[model samples]
Target: MSPRFLCTLIIVLGFVSCGLPAKRREDKTKCPHVKAIRNFDLHELLGSWFVVQYFASSEEALSYGCMRPVFSMSSDRLEVSMNFTYTFTDDPAAELLYGNITWEIPNPSRPSHWVHAEDTYEGVYNTYVLDSDYKSWALLLHCAEKSKSPRYLSSFIMSRQPILAPNVVTYLREKLPRYDIDLAYMFPMTQTNCSNTNRESGLDRDTVRYVIKQSESNRRHPMKRLHKP
Candidate 1:
């Protein structure tokens, strides 16, 4: 072969080799398993839930005992309101705090939802799974997609009180490890007061009582059919 032709052939082969696609790398990290329960009774799930304990992220400022978020159920969605107080160690009395949160359903068809503080466009998206019995505990995983650090996320183990029953709290604490949640900075809402009247005024007391009793009955006898609205 001619030297010029040989050089041209070598150039062509090198270009083709460079153009070949690189091998695709497999992602070893397992995606989070978001468990979903088939039956979630919204009525029993309603009412107010105090921030029992929460797992804090590095970016979150240490909250004073005054901060708490309340959850209540509407017809089809959940409403969340957060109120908090912040105090610096150097100036304990110079505390500053603000209150804000979004109340919306994940979407009628989707299990996930977005919770915004003031505007719909801005807020964290959450994936939640509730216990089968709706006894007063939930797992919340929140991701802030628009944050400066795109991968920012946090998890919380929320309950109805600052101190849950020993057995129940132990169960919840144990379950956190299975979900890759860190319990090191778990802050309990020790100073917050839980109000029993919150749920009474929203729905008719008689109606709420009837539903709770019916739910209890359904649980007792699984064979019986529970009417769904």
Candidate 2:
């Protein structure tokens, strides 16, 4: 296949995977919500979090070793800056995937629980801190959107350090069933070369264009989770 053909194919896949119908599917089970750590300090949570375990159903897999989410306080909401490295299906060299997601605490009583401040197709996107000590390990639950058939859920076990402790991983895994999340679908995310935030490739423009086009397509067809189960 010609290089141009491969490029065009990848662009098509990106848009198709991202573009989906936007219809709210309700989950029969009441959305899961573990109690947020009481009196959790948002200031303590403001910093870079290394994603240890990721549970998502997206068709695209998250790039390993570069999934870092940096958070900072902006007014009444939390500003999130996420950076990662992902490549086209067969391409080896990695490209950057960066975006900002803003979250706000709707209830002052539950400071650790937040809702998407920006428009999100995932109806009722809620992010809650299930457990965290503010120094070592943090367990997070992202209820992306509850669908009628398959629920779209994402949870993360983050840590201050790049690597998570073995015991913590075990504990987080055991906690999945309560939320009806399958442990088999969960996988550890890479934290390699995390310090090198400037990593980029010649295909940066292509990557950006694909992302932009995908986003626009999603706006038109906004109801489905892009990840495949």
Candidate 3:
């Protein structure tokens, strides 16, 4: 196929995968989380975190590498921002990609739970800290819901370093099933060669658009998990 056709197809696929359908279907996947850690310390949670593992209801495969997010909290501790760097797992060159996500704490009493501050979506999107020890590891859950559409859910096992103890990982994974997460779909993120990825990022216009578009599309209509049991 010609480059033009391939690019056109990619654009079309992005819309089909990410765009909401005219008629919404009932969300089959179950996700439930009403509260986050009580009296959460914003200062302790601030800093850099390595995304050690990831799971999403729509994901068909593992997609990122060298995934790291440096977090910053506002003075009042009401807003938080994560400036992240990541590279596609399949990219031979491992060209870095960057993005940012900001969240607002709706309830000051529950500092661990937050809602998306940006209008990335039209409806409610929540991020809850299921568990965290501040200096070591944290388990986070995210759920996005649109009117009459399937809820999009994803989880992250993050650490202060590139690796977390297997026992700690086991302890963290146990909390997910109650929210309808399949342990099998929770895949580790590769951190090898990650030390240097922060130094650079460059891609052609078409390639960048495709990659970013596809990444966004995976939010709702992902293909499948990268690892199969």
Best by TM-score: 3
Candidate 2 lDDT tens digits, 1-229:
9866776686677633234454654454346756767678877877877777777645335434355677777665544333333222222333334555667777776788887766654566677778777788787777765455444577778888889889888987887778767778777876663333223544465675565566543322211252344
Compose the digit string of candidate 3's lDDT tens values, residues 1-229. 9866776686677643334354544355324745667777877888999999988776668877777888898888899887888777755446666778889999888888888888755567778888889999998888876666567778889999999999999999999988878989999998887644322444565675666566664332121221212
Clash counts per candidate, in order, are 2, 10, 5
lDDT of 1 by residue, 1-229 (tens): 9866776686677643334464654322322455665655445554445455555444233333433455455454555433333222222222233444454555554334434434443334454543524566765555443444333345555565555666766676776655555666555544433222425336565665565455443222110111111
Could you report the Cα RMSD, in angstroms, for every candidate shown?
17.1, 16.2, 15.4
| lDDT of candidate 2 at residue 201, scale 0 to 100 | 40
TM-score for all models, in order of appearance: 0.52, 0.66, 0.73
- Candidate 2, poorest ten consecutive residues by summed lDDT: 218-227
Candidate 3: global Cα-lDDT?
0.75
Candidate 3 segments whose C-alpha is farther than 4 A from its true place: 1-31, 195-229
- Model 2 residue 205 distance off true place after TM-score fit, in angstroms: 8.8
Displacement of the residue 40 alpha carbon in candidate 3, Å: 1.6
